[model samples]
Target: MSLNPLRLASKALIALFCLSVLTGSVRPTQLEVVRMQGEITMVTRNSPTTFYEDRSGPTGYELELAQAFADHLGVQLRVVVADSLSDIFRLIDTQPGVFAAASLTRTPQRERLVRFAEPYQQISEYVIYRRGGLKPATPADLLQGRLMVTAASSHSERLHDWQASNVPELSWSESPELEVADLLQMVAQGSLDFTLVDSNEYRMLQAYYPTLDIAFNAADQRDIAWAFGWSRDDSLHQAANDFFAHIKPQPLLANLAERYYGHLDKLDYVGARRFLRQADQKLDTYRPHFVDAAGEHGFDWRLLAAMGYQESHWNPRARSFTGVRGLMMLTLNTAKELGVKNRLDPVQSIHGGSLYLSRLRDRLSDVPEPDRTWLALAAYNVGFGHLTDARKITAQMGGNPDLWLDVKEALPLLSQKRYYRHTRHGYARGQEPVDYVQNIRRYYDVLVWNDEQTQPLKGEELLASSAITVVPPLL
Candidate 1:
């Protein structure tokens, strides 16, 4: 009773600290909690742009980014897949998840509920419609058809803003059960009139849904960032910000973007349509041969198939003006070397091509995949000597010789005298391999998507497909 008021308050704080220590109730910082758990949980949506399983287990742009962050923290990554975009936000709000990395755009409405890390990407939203349909040339024309988007998505938020400010008549429905890919499919099938998709996503998926075309821009230049919960403890948030700052200047970020988004726009509407048609009408006849050869040579069957399509459009008797022929397009010397008796025979041609590609890949044992795979494919197309010349040029130009992105750039230089003059191989059609690899990657993507749609993963296999291994530090 006689103590000073400040003294009494200090005494109370000391008692509380002692009690907290005795009861084991001391609150740990978010970073400490994560360190104790030895794992960081990532909340994401299951989509091509977010998280999904491919032939090589779980791999997506977001998943890989999350993996890298987890590696930086020296912790394991635990992926939690949410059903919808709304579910992703709900999980981040309620759960102790580290962050949501599902390619979320930072909208004004979302900023009120959660804090966002540094913006990593910028994209535009486009109103998508099927070809041969009445295109909505302007925002006012959006009212002419049935438009829909994912519930709780930035696309819907954009629509709401448009409806409020300029076009009061612009209206659409929100589907909580479907994703952007589903909406695109609906538009292509004529079930829905139009939908909105981000430019990056539309580009990545356009080859699969060739009929869908961008009508107009719904929103432009939006920032995409990782979302964290708004809380008193912002240790994780600060750490994430630091992580981004460290990587922003490095090649790690650029390589990740190039890996996922660089080659997507290689095929146009007409080329995609033609590829799809041929894949449907002709690919089946040689599927068994591709499967057998790929299995024998340790390659994905779809990849082998894509290579065949790029080589000859899957024609058994395809002949190039330079004397390469057949489904895999083997020259006489290469065919003889690979023990291919008849280059026109589909089975023999596929086996020979697969073995040859595998041998080329093995030759570059020092190179890391998927760069190794891509380099091998380039060699398969432009000859190993020319590929070596390009790698030399890449190193000379101060680019990594192992990265496909750098090598592809240097490849075109081979056609020019100023660059190729000092090279072992003096002149080559360098641009051909660039286009060739891009075309195969696009075709392979379509095939993978088509296969997934027809046969999706389920149950135990789905659970086992998580990307858990820590990636080595980026160069």
Candidate 2:
């Protein structure tokens, strides 16, 4: 009954051929190939809204989502940087086992070329122009100015659709060499008339480019999702949909959005201009002190400087109504506890404040970072007791006490007598802490951007010293 080895091999090959004829082609599923390779390759573009280098090596809103999806599949994530939006799609078209997660807006044209996973976020397109420039009130007005968008982008597609259908006069050019951020900068510099950008991107960059303003919303809200190369196998696409479904009810997506965008709207044009002015005129004088304190305490010097600015606007002689004084705005008791003989001395105040913040973070050892750092900041503004009371209130409600977003909600409730009367620390201006933390975060972001722009020639190691971080260094 046993067959010869050569005959058995021939029989097996014939069976495989018959199966292939029936199924068209037999190949490993995309998910199976990824698992077998032990890694998934993702293509992304370099932008603040997508993937970019920071102190933590590489991170961004889109990168975070990609990493989560990779983890969901039980594989490692490998990122390949594409030079342009066109290049991103080209890589997808040519490569195997690769996907795009560059905050791509799903479009009809794109849907024909690739498969987009479930949409994770929605954003509207806006026509951006410099302040004091000719503002376009409608699509017709865009014809008057030089409007341009990135090549192969959703913005360009929208413009094309508009031009072909209703506004035949509405014409725009595509920039093969520039990105949305570059166009934004050009508009800010008065070199470009107008450009199209997403609402979220506009919000994130508005503080940095104070001169930029929205002319009008150009398109309706669109779905943003991950894109897979066109293939017969929808295995990976279904897996990505499953991953999104699993995280839909989780805090990861919300928290990531909050981390990247929550504080963006805090600084308006006037506030942004003032911060830039002071940073130019006064930051140089205290820069060394901040750096020294940061080195001693292992904090980003920009964070300390931002905190200092928020506290007293970087004035050494500044004093509050509550008797807090100096650049870092320390109370008399806090200054004494930190061994500062002269509360008005900028060096002493800066060091004392840094130490106090580190200690406050230490007290929050149980809380997970970013929330821990934000909560410590709130504690720095209000008090540890009030922060604990806020946490208690957050827990009493159906909110996650560990999340800053939820805790921030409960924080304002402390101001109301109805809620404060039951807490251990009654009657605190909870709204102040929320504003305090947000202002500091905004300042920190601007400072980071300023540093990066000024030191573009510096290598990554030097640049990383000015990068942002959510985690506090251990004492």
Candidate 3:
């Protein structure tokens, strides 16, 4: 088949045209499906800022923000959770209608690989090490320890930039196999002397590992945004810009960020350190009851413990001035209704509270869970009548009745004469429950992070359904 080069090229072009005509196929540009198919696939990177499975399926700022864009387009949302950042790049490259919600930072190298939307968040990089370990007070201080970072993360990139331009003293190893959370765990375990993580990442993990501390800022104010594959058409990118603008004024972005990071940093180091110590010192005696009750009621034992802490700080003999008493802090009427002979007994209190929360949760079967769990917690604080009143207000005010996010804002309005006047339940200390639920949620997050369950849930699957595993770091 050795013919003239021009003749061979002409024949190949002719064949390509013929094949396209026969198949009736036209390749769409990146993210063009929103125009033709009215939908887009969201690529989730399984991280706190990007995507992580929660007790209520996938819940993260990335997932929620992506959902908002999908809703705006009047299209169906198809979620694809990427295994890693590399997987995200590959998917975005080969697939149309796919965009990344990985909270990816805009970097010069990445800009060549993919286009980024307008920045939604600004974060700083930090030098992290265990609390009592070597403190890197300055750039010179970094030389005193074994430094490591996740291979592809922005932390490593920052180090590389420093190495190139300014600080020849800057040095660190990279862990190819570790996720950012696993890196945080490694530092907490003292496997690595120090590592670099973003400030938000450091703050979020500090709630879990109170022993980890920030030595100094590595880099400040990097922009984080969504990433899409490079393409000639900019329809989806423009739409993303519009979406962010619309939500910014409505403060949706701030609300979503608050849901994840707001309650963090509320519990101080001593308070958190005390909680972990007590979990070791005291939780064993009550673990059996918590585990049993949690199983029967479909609640995490940590959740029940958080409730116990919020109510009585794990003191079975503790009593409130309102006459509520014990670890679960049951009122006399609640105790009588639950058939408790003695409200002061730790066993009875835990069981009764678990049962009560279970019953309340059952009432919300029509609603989505995790949010339902949150609503149930609020009902436990104020009566169901008041909770419903708040829900009604939320619905009337152009918000979701079933979403805890909306209902929480409306909850405090119940104390206002203008709002509560229309309700069956009269004025209540509305701010108390709002704070109550938030504080317990903080404790619950920490508990889930610090403890491993003794028993796996039988036949019942958690809403997240799957998890990521990390191998122990190589020294």
- TM-scores of all candidate predictions against the true structure: 0.90, 0.89, 0.78
Candidate 1's C-alpha runs over 4 A off are 1-26, 455-475
In order, the Cα lDDT scores of the candidates are: 0.86, 0.86, 0.79
Per-residue CA lDDT of model 3 for 349-407, tens digit only, reads 99999999989989989898668988999999897888989999999999888878888
Please give the lDDT score for candidate 1: 0.86
RMSD of each: 9.6, 8.6, 8.4
Error of 1 at 252 (Å): 1.6
Q: How many pairs of residues collide in each model?
A: 0, 0, 0
Alpha-carbon lDDT of model 3: 0.79
Model 2 Cα shift for residue 201 (angstroms): 0.7
Error of 1 at 24 (Å): 14
Spell out the clash pairs found in candidate 1: none
- Model 2 per-residue lDDT tens digits across residues 336-377: 899998988999999999999999999988888778889989
Hey, what RMSD does candidate 3 come out at?
A: 8.4
lDDT tens digits by residue: candidate 1, 1-475 = 4879998899999999999889999688888899889999999988888888887799899999999999999899999998877788888888774689999989999999889999888999899998999699887787788777877888877777777778876767776766777778778877678888988888888998888899988765899899999888888988899999989877887898888888898889899989989988988888888899989999999999999999999988999999998989999999999999999999999999999999999999999999999999999999999999999989988999999989999999988999889999789999999989988888899998887787543323322442222212112
In model 3, the runs with Cα more than 4 Å from the true position are 1-27, 34-39, 54-56, 71-83, 249-255, 359-369, 382-403, 406-429, 451-475
